[model samples]
Target: MAELQIAEIPYEDGGIRYRYARRLSEDGTRWIRDGRFTAYHPNGAIASEGTYSDGIEQGLWRDYHDNGRIAAEGQYDRGQESGVWRYWDSDGRDVNG
Candidate 1:
């Protein structure tokens, strides 16, 4: 698996300066295996986390609410939904119960 290097791009929201790790989706598939991809909210919390295979999502992927809660978790096979799915609310509570 290739290592991830995060960098910040500057922007402004309500005059409060902030930075976000840029969107990292690319088409290269030769380097990353068992890879982890992450995105963050402007408030500095987790926005999403997932694994990829040859550039296609092939495992459990979790997406968070802006409030740092898990909004969804599910399995993917070659980018298509392919298993049990769980969703959560903004408080990190599972909604699939």
Candidate 2:
């Protein structure tokens, strides 16, 4: 099996600033970035994922719990939350809107 590929930039405070990953294409090409961005938790679980434009977060972004369940989900405009947002518990129950 082929291993997944990821490229990451770190913040000055030792957190991730941005990250990009390789994904297989419809035509079988390996592409990096491809619009989706991800950050990892200290335990290596996905902390958040969303689209970016010019280094700013855009579109839908989802944050996850340490147990791997979605904790919150919402849309973003230039790294700011925009539109209606929702929150969920680790058991997948909607806790907020």
- The prediction achieving the highest lDDT against the true structure is 2
Clashes of each: 0, 0
Q: Give stretches of model 1 more than 4 Å off.
A: 1-34
Q: Clashes in model 1: which pairs?
A: none
lDDT by residue (tens digit), candidate 2, 54-94: 44678999999877999999998877999989999989899
Compared with the true structure, all predictions reach lDDT values of 0.65, 0.76
Give the C-alpha lDDT of model 1. Answer: 0.65
For residues 14-75, what per-residue lDDT tens digits would candidate 1 score against the true structure?
32222222233365533333456666677767777777665577788888887876799889
Q: Model 2: how large is the Cα RMSD against the reference?
A: 8.0
TM-score of candidate 2 on Cα atoms, chains taken together: 0.62
